[model samples]
Target chain A: MKCNAETIGLMHKYLDGDITTEEEQQLKYHLEDCEACQEHFRELKRTLTLIQSAERFEAPANFTANVMKNLPTEKKQVKYLRWFKMHPMLTAAAVFFILMFTGVFFTWEQDNQLVVSKQENLIIEGDTVIVPEGEVVEGDLLVKNGNLIINGTVDGNVTLVNGKLIDDDPLDNRGLMASVGEINGEFESVDQTFDWILYKLKGFAKKVFSFE
Target chain B: MEQIIREKIILVKKGDQSAYEDLVSFYQNKIYQHCYRMLGNAHEAEDIAQEAFIRAYVNIHSFDEKRKFSSWLYRIATNLSIDRLRKRKPDYFLDAEVKGTDGLDMYSQLQSEGASLVEEVENNELQRYIHTKISELPPKYRSIIILRYLEEFSLKEISEILDIPIGTVKTRIHRGREALRKRLRHV
Candidate 1:
């Protein structure tokens, strides 16, 4: 309704072509009787024009060369930094695995002790036996608490009381009564042999290590 | 021109030093002028402009190709200039009112008839006087004025470069123009 400095300011915006239609109408209505505000708006426009037309300063002749010369040597380290930033989860997982493996490696001696003790028990039990091919046996063979595989020729009777007998030639019997192999003695199945041996080893280990 | 700049930027990212040099040469004057207008000192402008380019080079890999390279460079130069200004004038306040001179002084100065637009353009003194007055404004307002007028950045571009909201950019532009007009009314 009334004209003021703000009206003149709006008039400045209007001169800049930055005012909305409503503001334009308001400034036009105010300016119809406001000759002083009109002159102020004219001066503001001139000031803006003067500033916009100010000459820009030129850069120094060697500005680019100086910038290039002062640049830090491009460190390849930025590549790794960017990679880690890009794949944060992957980097964290890799770091975690590396730390875990390092911890395991550092404590490997203690773990090896436990493994060595278990291996000693297995050796004492002797549950697995290997027979190489092309070897010959001349005397009676007796195996207990183990599997006996025959890949070689045998000249004597074989008896397995607490183990399994595996022979490739089933009809190679020479002196004993056998359907698949020669046997001079009685063969018996000991189904509970492994359980029995494991129980005994547990008892022995508890005694040796004083485990509660 | 934009396509060529993008291609050169890609090469720079791949460690092509020559391409990097070309980019520096292309943008040196533009950046220098922006810094000079914002800073009002030739030596400081050159130093800060050089620093801005070096920083851009070091961080080139992180630059997104979707944005214009010139905008990015201007942003760097602006930020550097603002930092230098703040460090140099630790007590400067952007929102502080112009002291001592109420609206009357500006009105009186405006009334004292100065040279016409044609005469001011013909002479370099008016230009230098306007430049000095712009430099005398608070760094925040001066920066916006330079970006808007000298750099010819749009309101949205100024927002992006200054990392401010478009509303804030518009408000600052209005206030900055007002401040400059008050200062240049006498000249």
Candidate 2:
């Protein structure tokens, strides 16, 4: 077999002892007859051998130290970076500050005014004065002879009708009117035709003390 | 034997810099040689190898003791070398080509001294030529070749080091060696 570039290429496998016996025989036969191919094989082998036997150059005396010096004392930086990387809360806090600063700078000129209107305005002409759940009543809630159902929260005191002032909540103190023909009773409730007085002789005692 | 490596690894995890240094010293030569072959420059190879050790020391905490320490070290060294190679695009290919020419011409000048020159200058020229040819290869092929031929690591070790299948290592080594041979034909 004549040796060309392709056949010569197979000599690599031959030199590395990678080719099987049959290919080896074929390459050997080709090498025996061809001077150029044999020279090429010798040159290749010689080069590989030289490279293998060549004394490897060493790094300079201060090489390791120089590398260490250039390496940014990465121990401390890496420790800090790793700590920050592992601690998501710290990273989140940093990100939050950054975002806040960025947002303030970007939106500094935007209008952020908050307007508050007058809270309370109501009128009760007949049966129903309806208000939403959270609406606040600013002035006194006055009622005359009709039952008042307060669905919304009252901001001020409520006055009731018929001299029979009523309050369902135990925390409320229903102040009674003084006896002068001006709605006068001691916060009394007519319970089964009997009077239940809430604040009785306390005022009488106060009057006795004033007698001096 | 493997159990001893595991214990050393445990000590390393406990922040034993001496244990880590032992590990570094053990593999540093092979790693340096591998990097040197890959980078084709002594200074860069030393820097890369040292960096690899530092990284290995810091990240020893993350290593699985079940695996070979040498494999892990090789992986770090290989990665660092590849990264450095990527960042280094020769700013002057023309200048590099000129340098190559100058080297060949200098060797040829020494060749005028006859058969003795053949022993010294020819051998040096061939060795330098082999280095240049190998350096021309792509990083992947270059790595396998350097690890296989120059470092003379076992195919199994090379596979583990590069985190590749052995068959892939074999294929790359075959291709790379053949490529080097082909390129050096002109030398």
Candidate 3:
């Protein structure tokens, strides 16, 4: 087998002993007869040796010290990280998500009984219960197979199916309260009742405090 | 269980300055040689070598006990040198590997020693040419050439350092060397 430019090109790595056993054999077989490739191989080897043996420069007297002087403070931080490591964003986001999750969970736990009672009332009433504005129902709700009219707010889902509702935005009913058939009326404004109650409570609180 | 090496590693990792110094002293020559060969400059090589040791000192925790420590150190030095080459490419090719002021045949002057000197000078020039041509090769091939020639690392050592298959290292080295030789032939 004759060695060509391609084979001779590989001769540098070959001479450096970087060639594979198979490649070594192939190169060896080719070089056994191919004088030009063999010569190229030897030259390449000599070059690698001369290059490796060439004089090397040493670092300046204070090279390491200089590097140390400019060393990043992150060295201390990497070790610190090994001991306790977490990304700031991930940590903050984790805290936020945990707080959010826990907030929902705790609220569900505290107000669960009220929600249950409202659900029971709806089931028991089993018919349209007209709730006047500013009226508060302190029991669970269950609107069974019937329409609920909201002249005011029922503290829970006002379910209706094939029933008429005489309010503006009727699609606000969604989420964990889906057991109710449907809802009627724009109850978004119904949230103001809390402010109204706080107003009355403030008056009562003021009257009570005034006596003190 | 190479107790001496094991103890040295343990001491260095424990932040023992003396142990670290001992390790530095032991490998400084080879490390400098690696950087010098890669960068074709003594001063830069020396700085890179020193920085490599410092890095080793800081990252000793990541070193696996079963592997050779010098190989790891050499890897860092080589990478640093290559990075320097990339940053200073235009200036690097112009450095002082050429002949004297007269630009007389440097090869002949080097060859006065003997016919062997011819190959030696040629090889030196060839390897020097490799420094410039190497940048043109793929990074993987470039790394193999640097490791094999500049660091004189064995195929197995390179495989260990790079965590690649030894066969792959062989192929890349072979291919990379061929590419270099071809490139030099044209020059």
Instruction: Give the RMSD in angstroms, all C-alphas superposed, for model 3.
Output: 20.3
Tens-digit lDDT track of model 1 for A106-154: 5433332211111111222245443445555556565555666555445
Task: DockQ for candidate 1, please give it.
Answer: 0.33
Off by over 4 Å in 3: A1-35, A61-212, B87-143, B179-187
Q: How would you encode candidate 3's per-residue C-alpha lDDT over A1-212 as one tens digit per residue?
A: 33476676456555655568888788788888888877677656654554354333455556545555544344454454444434767767878768855664464345322122243222223344555444555433443233455444455443332233444236655452333333333232212334434533565579979966
Q: How close is candidate 2 to the true structure, as a TM-score?
A: 0.47
Model 2, residue A194: distance off in Å is 90
lDDT (10s digit) by residue, model 1, range B5-90: 99999978877666788999998889999898888766678889988998898899999989989989999998999998878756
Better of 1 and 3 by lDDT: 1
**Winning candidate number (DockQ):** 1
My TM-score estimates for the predictions, one after another, are 0.56, 0.47, 0.44
Q: Native-contact fraction for each model?
A: 0.67, 0.16, 0.17
- Assign candidate 3 its CAPRI class: incorrect
Q: Which candidate order results from sorting by DockQ in descending order?
A: 1, 2, 3
The CAPRI class of candidate 2 is: incorrect
lDDT for residue A47 in candidate 2, whole number 0-100: 55
Provide the lDDT at B121 for model 3: 67
